[model samples]
Target: MKSKIKAAFNPRTWWPKAKDGMHNMSPLVAFFLLNLFLVWIKTYINYLVNFNLGVTGPIQNFLLVLNPIPTAIMLLSIGLYFRGKLSYWLIWIFNLIQSLWLFANILYYREFTDFLSFGIMGSGSATGNNLGKSIAAIIHPTDYLVFLDLVIILVFLLLRKIKIDRKGIQKRYAILTILLGLILVFVDFGIANVDRDGLLDRSFDNNYIVKYLGLNEYALFNANQTYQQSNTRKKAGPKDLQKIQQFVKENHSPANVSYYGTEKGKNVFVIHLESFQQFLIDYKVDGQEVTPNLNAFYHDQHTKSFDNFYNQVGQGKTSDAEMMQENSLFGLNSGSAMVKYGASNTFESMPGILGQMGYTSAAFHGDVATFWNRNNTYKSFGYNYFFSKEFYPNANKPSYNVGYGLKDKIFLKDTAQYLQQLPQPFYAKLITVTNHYPYDLDKENISFPATKTGDNTVDGYVQTAHYLDQAFGELMDYLKKAGLYDNSMFVLYGDHFGISENHQPAIAQLLGKDKVTDYDLGEFQKVPFMIHSSDLDGGIDHTYGGEIDMMPTLLDLLGVPTNNMTIFGHDLLSAQNPQIVVFRKGGWVTPKYMKYNNHYYDTQTGEELYLSKDKELAKEAKANDAYADKVLSDSDKVITGDLLRFDKRTDFHKVNKKNYDYSKKATLKALKRSQETNPSSVLAKNDGHSTTDEYTTDAPEYSSSSK
Candidate 1:
């Protein structure tokens, strides 16, 4: 009994005891350390190069290199339990997993400048789209370095340079390694908190978390956050909406007296200009207009455009813009609310609100229904119809489809047929995707000259934008010929920024600037937003607003009041609106001042403000800063907790998911069924004849399959 007791506590009893200190580690322990070191190095390099944490000072720089150690140890230690070759193999597997995760973030950061979150993985449908091609388009050759160590290890094993460990590690030593990792984690956290106060509690930006800690640590933090959000939503009830209700009442913008209900009962058409930036408007290259058609439309007599309309979106990008436009709420601070909560969360969305007034809401996108998990999200929005990729005959063909979705010209031509089938007063959204990132257009379709900005990313931009403009012009002509133009209200807006900060030098070249300041980038966030309806008095209204203002603005025009609604946006046409545009990152832009990266800038002159010298200006900036913070926090809370599901002032039922059938057969059947009952559509109005023939395109790839 005494011998057994001694052996239980002795390290040599379970693990192979070789030597002391340097040579004391068994093969199992050595393997764990090897993989941990590899993972640590790869993660550190990726963070420095790919993840833009805005490394500002010495402390943050140190933390950036040191933050991944604890996570690497914790993760690699899991493989130590198995004995023999399996243990070694498991450690290799873990090393591969860590490298793959880092690689994934590199891909994501290229597009969003953000890290991966639990919601992306938790929602399995997020992976169902043509992710392979999108991934291929973004990945650089250097990104393959992440898997170098894995290949090295495999080669070493095959060449008999590294032996498979036959013995298992002692449990006590495994616990000790994990405890050491935990101790280091605490030390790292303390240092981070010292560098940035409230580092964990109030840091809304993912970059701050990753800057202070690490990507692996951020993943853990995001997982906890996602869990907390889900649990909070589950525990929410009607009583919890009081604060939201009170807040909305205090901040709500009254409807503009001049425009309220002016376009009531008009057919609503929202044209989603994907990845389009306002700089393209009247932007001439060598005196040649890049988007001549759109520029003409922007200055049309009946168009009410906003030159200063910024797109307020974060990691969710296009989806974030959609949420703000449709629901009048900001997205989740960490992940996409659309991808995370769209299927389950209750929303007082545009479709749901307008449905009560007999509007048949439908969305048209050339992409597959599951691209952003929209198949499920559209149902939550109470959309009566969704015409997605399967509805477009040749959408899957290589000629029709690019990396994102179908070509714009083909999509616009195909969709005219469907547009004629929707009922009268329909709320239709047409999403164009030819101008998306990595702008790839066939040689035959390139009608405009590419920019010679010495940046490949921005070079092909104008060409695609020109193509989209052509498509846009064709669709508009169809709308007129089909008799759907004069009676409808058209809302055209760019979804998000086309060129991210990653290609700043090219952007600077395009704009003829030597370098881009954060202030300039703040202004660069502006996207085109125009409201056009024939015979309506309109002009270029220079209002400082963001996508969040879309819902309230449209509602006001439709003679709707948002008294009981929980919304954070102000109508753009109302004088009561605080015209301070708030970005998802804890920064804001006003006509007088712009606050970004924890610094203030003069909005007009692009000069940085020194708070020590400008006391009066500082005071006003602080007030706007606080107001914007509250707006963002409150909006985030509403989305995260799904508090709107408990709206008490009205008895409107939540969207019944069963009633929304997105299948092609059901969509056609429903349109036909509605025609028999209502007979209010353009096709019904035209004596049941097709109107698709009116859409004529000069697209080089246009064929019968596309038509």
Candidate 2:
């Protein structure tokens, strides 16, 4: 019976035990246990960070089940070591396999570099913050974990050499391994049960394994709630549709009347200036000017300057700005919306709308069309032609290198030539590319005119801007000479804020201050949006607007009938409400206040704006939260392909067919329909919720109360 029991416990009992058996066992066990713990920790952390655990319960459970492989390997290694035949070659092989597997998994997730960057020091390392360091520390643990494990094995071997037989110790290790294996198997089965019910309604809370694990339950709960909310939006009832329709009907105005321009078959030129900011024009350098041409244009032209305009580019930066401006879609939160959605043929855009109106449409960029996948996006957006670096003659030859493309001068000249060649009444989008990063003009070998003066880098940027300004002047002059100026509309806007700390400092110096208190870190993102035409009546219009509003506003001005399906933007000339600009960085800037995520910043001081008395600030906070929820919900629809179905069903005229002459009959009909459908309007009135009452009247006013 004793022999049988011993045989069951140890298969190696028939073989003679080596002196180093005990010595090898400890190091092997320690290494195995430490690695096992690390693998489990990493798996848990990755699930927490990437996937919402509550929503991905099944996946999480599966990961947990798989988490024991490393540990099992380590345990097997320990048994081999305790067999007194542990080879250095076998240990090296195991280490190599583990290292390669870890690296392979990391690379597969595109996080290998991130892992190595935490003082691990590997090629193509992607360094993050302290979070990365903590993760690395957990993965490797301490040298002692491995050293002690090896030391224990060595100790057993040493003891055995000194005439100590440790047969009982081996029997104890066998029992311990079996117990651990059984425990892990049971845990894996438990996790599997939760995973199996992950998609069920009960799985939301009942089958949420992470909740039991006490790992980021709040985040998991929030994720589940978000998913439910998204489903609610998707499965909106007839009542919800009616509410939306009523909202549009009551707020809607005649497109032409609302946009402040008569409908005509005018050629539209949209220039998206890269990284151009409002401060560039307003800022003065050494008691002089940084952007003399832009300043002069603002002053001399029939300009309507929007003092409260804000930039709302999402994570996609330039592409996001373009998408917001032209597509009338909200900015994306995660990926490049333009690139992702642009490739699909189903996506609708403003250029596509214009193209439907029998106008030739084109997009011009001096850079490669492949950059940001503009070529595919533009084509999908119904552009008949795309002029990129490939279209430029001798573009491969060495010239002044701007940020992402050829010099501004070359881009401007090429764009102008293309525009001149295009058919009349064409919709042309010109994206300029001089004012990008590295801000070094001398490095690019670009020279300015004799009329300009400053340090080479500043002078180079100034010169580049001047060159573009001259190009603009030349284009307008040509149009005038050709008698096309009166029929063409020029819409110019900046893609983003310029990268010039020197310009900011220069502005501060000119103002005789260290920093502009009114300008916050977020304020640097703001750029200019202007619409200029020689034929239209011009005045200073301090209108608050953003990139998303551009398309609807322009479409309205062009006398194109638009529906809610066309855009989220309201007509800038309509009597709608005060404008709000939202950023992907989770902040919004209005005329009176700047709101970050859950916090409001004082517009002037850039400090946290709060109430000294009572819970008035709390009420505002609630409203802000609601606003954020609405915005995010609306944005998510567009990003997640839910909005694509509306493109096919929408007929702009079906919703917008009003009296062209603003007749009372049409107005009365619209009013009656609006009144019948709008329960929210009644609710708002009953609640005394007026836009003017909510915000301070002393805040900077826009030219129109619309947007």
Candidate 3:
């Protein structure tokens, strides 16, 4: 009876015994440790995604407290359960694999592309070396921490193998390790869920942890508040709708305008020149000019060049520009909204609108349709056909350049031919790539006269711009020869400002300036949006406008009714109060000579801009933020395939019952269908392929470095 009592009281009777400190560790403990490590890595990555430390303030303290506890417990438990095996070579291998995975995740978080070759061997500021240096700097601390953590873990495991040996000691150590691990697990799970409810709420904390260490609780709270605010849309009163109806009726009424040859039946030719800036127009070399053809063409055509246009280039860059121009949507602050919401096909795009209006919509580009997940977007947007590099057999394949595809000249030529062949009254969107980076035009092949020397990138861009201009001229000439010039309307704009400092600096040098300052820099993004016709009286309308305004403006010109759509832009030809051109940099520069950059600015003096005491700016900011949120949330739906089931027959009664008007709900439903049916509709020109094929190519490969 005394022996039985002694055995029951002994630690070895109930707990697993080991001679060394790590002997009692289990496989389950190891598995838990691995998962905890993964969670920590995920949390770190989330931080990078949420805030640019250079931009946003450091994450709150509470969030950092949530990650390490689980990991410590799991590690301790594993060490106890597998004390004998933990010292084996397999443990080392496991640690090595985990370290590699951590490194890979960090690289992925930094968006390092394996396919792209950096020209680090080059001898220029824009060289691959310089670009690589910049990228390294941006991803430094986070990547280094991952490496350091891996090294530390490896060393700790190695030390454990060497320090412990006796069987009796291992048994005692394992029991202690298990006890400690259990305590930690309880504390971690308890603290983590103290104020949280269910998995969704807990998941929000995970997301928050990604944004900042020790700030998950604060992030969760903020996110919840934001979510609530986002779902609440201000009801557009009857008076507001009536005002919009009246505005549309007055200017777009078919009988009110001059009956020019440019009519509703005319085909539309739109060109989105990649990184084509207005700087090219004035750039000169020696005694000759950089873009003589463009300069002359702009002068010849009835061009409406804005002296103060700005680009809102967001995280998506070219894709964002495409979204703004085609769908009249705003650029999102949270990553790539197109990729996020692309699956559901939510927005009613220009192609779809044109398609409904009996226009055979087509898109043309010099690169692969899959480059930006454009193939899916184009189809979703209602394009009848897409002509990419794959379709252009006669394209010149250049060497040394990373982005090899058809030249803009060939693209333009093929596009013109295709437009002519297509059934009449078509809408053709032509995207040019000649001005894109790694600008590698040979001097011998340059058709334009050169004025600059030494700067190859600038020279190449100038040459390409010249070629594009010539192509544009030729297309215009073809239209005239085909008797389509008078009837068709052509709109040309740049996708964004040129990414080349060499090109920008060359232009500055030509203009006898160090840098193109202030409003001029803004105008650099503002390319010429020309509308030329032999019959319509051509004159510049000095009304302020933006890419977002393009859709409504075009619809207005064509006498089409834009029913119940929430567009961020207004028609330039109409009296729609003061105009505001918002930049992706969060600047709100108005045509009324007001410049805002998170704060207000006086355009003339370049002073810090501020809101009125009555919170006018705050109200506007809130509205804009809400709008941006909606765009992102809606896009999320598209990317996740939430809108795939939506059809014309889908009832909007429930949505309308929530206080959102029937028209608004119907518009949302239509947008969802568009996203589901044409995932790449907003940016990529579709070829009317199967929906399955569209989604299959929806995964986009982003460039490793900023051009």
TM-scores of the candidates are 0.90, 0.59, 0.57
Q: Model 1 Cα displacement at 337 (Å)?
A: 2.5
* Candidate 1 Cα deviation (angstroms), residue 634: 3.0
Which of candidates 1 and 3 is the stronger one according to TM-score? 1
lDDT of every predicted structure (CA atoms)? 0.84, 0.52, 0.49
Q: Tens digits of per-residue lDDT for model 1 on 669-699? A: 9889888898999999888998887778888
Model 2 residue 126 CA deviation in Å: 20
Sort order, lDDT high to low:
1, 2, 3
Task: Give lDDT tens digits, candidate 3, residues 395-440.
Answer: 5444311243566555655555445445557788888776665455
Candidate 2 lDDT tens digits, 1-707: 99777765573552334476742434444444454455445444544443222333355556544543524444344443443334322443444444344433333222111121111121111112322432342242332232343445455545653222223234455564656666664565466555444322322121133323322222234445445534643564445434444444554544545345554578888877776777667554345565665666565455445555666764456777888787767655434565555554245577777866767677877766666767666765667667777667645755534456666555554454445445556788888776653344443233343223333333444545544554455455545544446677877788765433324444344335677432454566568777766656555566566777788778877877666553556665555644666655455666656765334666656776664442765566556545644554455455554445444344421111111212235423543343335422222333422222212111011123421
Provide the clashing-pair count of each candidate structure: 0, 7, 53
Which of the predicted structures, 1 or 2, would earn the higher TM-score when compared with the native? 1
Rank order (by TM-score, best first):
1, 2, 3
Instruction: Kindly report which residue stretches of model 1 are placed more than 4 angstroms away from their true locations once superposed.
Output: 1-37, 77-92, 162-174, 610-625, 651-654, 703-707
Model 2 Cα shift for residue 96 (angstroms): 15
Task: Judge candidate 3 at residue 512 and give its lDDT.
Answer: 67
